[model samples]
Target: MRRILAVLLIAATTASAAAAGQSGKPRYFVKAWLQKADKTFEHTTSWCGPDQHCLVPIGEDMIELRELSGSSYYLRFISASSEDTPCCVFRNGSREARLESEYPRVATLYYRPEIWGGRGVTKFGRLIIVVEDLY
Candidate 1:
């Protein structure tokens, strides 16, 4: 009886640990950019693929962009759905202007138009995101 009880306890502990790990949210890379005139431009196309896509929070979403100088920027939005499609926005200080939408799922070619001044080819860039499963 003692041996049986010990085995059951160990099994329970292992099951709990597995459950905890599964409950943790998964991390994903989200690529954001603009598309214009049937052209797409951006940097770091890690997450824009057929098997991979941007993961958005079920509720409110917050994204932070960190620069090489250690400075950061924040973007907050609600209802970022998978069916809503992907796009990029240009930032000018506190003002954010939407550039364009409708980008290829995984293609890494083409050039996205620059919405903030004639800054050559403006690639908004990529960001790592942790999305919570709000079932």
Candidate 2:
């Protein structure tokens, strides 16, 4: 039937994409930047405080991210298995780098109005300026 054909088509595409990538651990990254409430984009962490105008100052360990978390500047990566979906690192507020892959499929991005765009954070204090795809 049409449904079966469609399912086969999708599986074929995914297999093709997986094979195209290099022989290594499958991984991806997300990029974003930190913006002060003063409307200025701060590439590096500065005098940002947790309960002040800036919550993430320079050298602050951004362990907690949108969907990823770890120690200091680097995050942990978990490989995918046949029974589980692939994992990704949400590299938020990183303006210099972007996430890319040779694979044809990828994760979809969306805006979180209730979190950063709500009141504090970017609207009133500080925020991690992540693009739609980075979040």
By lDDT, who's the top model here? 1
TM-score of each: 0.18, 0.22
Q: Put down candidate 1 lDDT per residue, 55-112, tens digits, no spaces.
A: 2221233333222111222333222325333334433323222211222122122123
Clashing pairs in 2: 32-93, 32-94, 33-93, 45-58, 46-58, 49-54, 49-55
Predicted structure 2: clash tally: 7
User: How do the residues 72-108 of candidate 2 rate in per-residue lDDT, one tens digit apiece?
Assistant: 1222222222323222223342222232222121222
Query: Which portions of model 2 miss their true places by more than 4 Å?
Result: 1-26, 44-63, 66-135
Task: Give the C-alpha lDDT of model 2.
Answer: 0.27
Best by TM-score: 2
